[model samples]
Target: MFIRKLWAYLLGYLILVIKGEHPERLINLAYTRGVHLWDLCWIDAGTLTAKVYASSFRTLRHIAKKAGCRLRIRRKRGLPFLLFRLRRRRMLLVGAVVFCLILYCLSSFIWTVEVSGTRRISQQKVKELAAEAGLRPGSIRFQVQRDEVVDHLLRELPEIAYAEVNVGPRSRIRISEKQLPEPGVGYCHIVAEKEGVIESVLTLAGQPLVREGDVVRKGQVLISGEISPAPPGQDEQQGEQLPPRQEPRFVQARGIVHARVWYRFYGEAALEEIQERLTGRKTLIFRIKVPGKEVIVYGPREVPYQFCRLRTHRYKLQRWRNISLPVEFVTIEAEEVRHQHVRRSYEEAVEMAAERARERADRGLPREAVTVRRRYKVLGGDEDPVRVVLTVETRESIGVIRKFRPENQTDKTGGKEGV
Candidate 1:
């Protein structure tokens, strides 16, 4: 159907309104004569409307005369008519072509340059370096060599480990910086950071001081850095004496100690409370700010609602490099709100209080902690505000490194070594 309509448009067509004794006779005669007519609509008992191709309209005129119907052209359409109109307004055609050319020319040049993944190195520095490599704004997109830009960035910045350049209308340059490894702390003991019952222990390079299911206190050593070697056995057959005991060795302790920890939180919710919310009715105020004065473009002088929320956003014209305009387009959105007193049931208040206690506990809990169980308790009389005590049990790693000097050690200053 679209192809047929496009064909009619390319060849030009006319909308004709036929009126007289019998307009249907004209349509039947045109159909029998193999002259196609589409979009036929009966206006009344003696009038009809239809569209016919410009080339076939002559044949329709003859058909109309034989059917005793007079035909009047309603509208002329298609590319031929458009060309004729443009032929008179030559400047409009020229302007349209020039606009298209401008868009095409602008698309070939880079307009904005952005730099990402930069931490130690400043974004401005990276952009300047990229500009030196011929990847700056206003440069031709096809002429900017990505490989050269990447090489330039890596060579100019010693901290940059990797670099990538994407060339387009808004060119983006991404870089990865080199990271130095942290120095290691030698000879340390792993101690319990919190008081809990040990659920499990994984000793990687340490002497185990406590086993699973053992109750430990805060600052207690869960894994010791001092390791003692086993004593030599006696030779009973030859009656030989036992060897001397070896001294204990102190090394860094490394391990994971998971323990079960408990937390208690208290919360309360009033049975009667006031709640304020937006009524979804809003008023907008637009203004222009220039230097020291502001002028309102539209909207009321004062807010309509007594109690409302105001959200203001300011926009300015696009700046070039370091130059910025003082004028700003400010839009203020005032949303009307109403406050009402709400009375919740005793059971509802209790549930709300419990949820609040649970949320508080969750916020205080560590991200790596896994919840194991929860218990809730209600306090106060039924008439009082719903007060709840929430007890949460969780399992988490409780081991932390505690540095200590070796026994009987001395520093360069002739002072005894300390933790």
Candidate 2:
């Protein structure tokens, strides 16, 4: 079929209007005579239009005469006629070729640069570094050293832990950078995250404020950032007769404070519940959307399903830079549905309720937590809705870093937020 179309296009074709009393006879005669014609359709009561090869169209004129039909060319198409028309506009042809050449040349050069993933480094600074490695806009794509550019960026920015340069189509350069971890706080302390008994305390650079077996409340400071030097030994003081004055020293203390924490959860499920179910009937609709309006291009104009659930998805056309058509395609699917009530037995309801309760009880439990104990209980009898309560106990580190106030910016409440 494609070969036939190509043959017609190369030899040229014509849309001829056959107007006469017996146009149908003209079509049959042409077919029997081995004259190719396509896209045949009735134009009106006495007129018919169809495509015929240019050479065969000439013979069609002869057939039209014998068949009592008058034939006239309505439109001319295909490469032969196109070239004939262009012959009269030589300058236009030259200009089109020149425009195409210019486009091809311009597309070969890089036009845009995009930098991403740099938090501390500015885009302009990064671009400058990239330019030194031959990655700036207007540079030849084949000439740019992608790996060298990445290595250069990493070399110039010590904080950058990961660097990559990706060259995209249309001469676009993208730089991805990942910076190092942020520096530690100048001053901070360890505080209890929840109300629990202190399991143990290990002070690395802070004053121990809580000890093992000591009960502590949420937000209580387990290790103080401030440290006071122990009083000089008595023997040293006696030998000197006078000891140097010692003042309490403040430090950015750090330590680990672990405490036991507990959580509780409750859940309820009915023995019978109503649920929406699909009826297996569905309709898919397509639409074209402009900036402010939309028109349905396919499917039923009016919604087909009365009791149905709808899901809509939209897709925007592929774009280049900031240039894009203000048009979008949307597809909507409506599935017919109905509501049904499902009844469950006591065992089924209990199992469902327990699962829900377990999810809640496990909420916020750390991976390192060791489950010391768990308890479950039904709060109500075999009612439609049965209530269940779940309690869990786990042993895990609860130490949370709580920053200490600077000496000059001390809060009036004496660090009340962290106790």
Candidate 3:
């Protein structure tokens, strides 16, 4: 059956009815001439129908006329006939080719950008920088280079430690940026932030004021910027006069001052609490959106649930490599929800409050600091607001840059120059 149909379509064929005297004679002539025919049937004494290739149809003409029979085409089919019809509408064919060309052209250009992993940097700023590097929306996808764009971002923004520009489908570009940490305060002295004994000292730059095992108080200068260098390899004769008087040089102090610090946090929570949440009842509506118009072809016309939260997700139709289409498919879901009351036992509330307090205390911890000790205390009963207090003892750098003027240093030798 497949072979017969294929043969008919390949050369184009016609279904014909023959009428005249001795139509049987025409059939015999077709067989003798090797004209392919199938499904030959005699409907009445004067009429008969059969299938023949379009090329064989003309071959039967002379045979039918000689046999005193007339052949009439009941239906025409196949590629040849279709092409013949299409040839008449020249403009339609041209329009179809033009439409395809336009689609391809539009798809080659970028349309939108998605930025991720940015905190201080704004979306517009990122886009502007990307635009300068030829990665902006509306730029040609094939023309825009991702590596070059990344290089441009790193060069333009000193804060950016890492950057990535990824081109994806639907004419969209995704940007990822990691910012470098800002430098510490410049030109300042490191001072003691709390009263504690100096366990050990590591001076990167500056003069050491307090030595190891020395007890220092709050606001005390742990590392001083003023220094008087001893004469190189020179023997000091106390009985002899000094060669000359040396002046102390003032500079910015820098170093880590490890001191014992205390962190305290307080937290309270009520035994009874109310929260609004979804009730698991929801309705989903599917739709198609084009420009400013939306048409729902499936699902409910209106939301089926009351006191519900509605979430709509829309996906625009797109083609090869980020070529977005104007049409979009949207799924809207309505979830029913209500206010819920939660009652916690005294033990439960205390644990919750304690965790919150602990988190708060830990929040203020400095990087690389060792937690030497930790303690927790509960102050209120479950009937009252459960209050939990957390305290932590840490050993970390309490030193921060405190800038000072060189002129403020007192003259140790009563000289006019300040140390």
Best by lDDT: 1
lDDT of 3 by residue, 1-419 (tens): 99889878978999999999798888898999999789889999989999899988878999898999999999999989988887998788889899999998988888887777677778778888888988777778889888888888867764444576776434333444332112333345678877777876667677888877787888888887666665645446655544544766756665656667777889887789876798877788999989889899888888876677888898876576877678989999888888789888988888889888877776867654678998888884445789988888877666666666555545442222324
Predicted candidate 2 versus true structure: per-residue lDDT over 14-69, tens digit per residue? 98888998788988999999998889899797898899989887788888899999
In model 1, the worst 10-residue window by lDDT is 410-419
TM-score of each: 0.49, 0.46, 0.40
Off by over 4 Å in 1: 1-183, 228-246, 312-331, 407-419
Q: State in Å the error of residue 363, model 3.
A: 4.6
Instruction: Kindly report which residue pairs in candidate 2 clash with one another.
Output: none
lDDT of 1 by residue, 3-32 (tens): 999999999999999998978788899999
In candidate 2, where is summed lDDT lowest over 10 consecutive residues?
174-183
List candidate 2 segments past 4 Å from native: 1-184, 229-245, 278-282, 290-294, 302-307, 316-326, 361-368, 380-384, 406-419
Ordering by lDDT: 1, 2, 3
Model 3: residue 359 alpha-carbon error in angstroms:
3.5
Flag regions of model 3 displaced more than 4 Å. 1-187, 192-199, 210-221, 228-246, 275-339, 361-364, 381-383, 402-405, 408-419
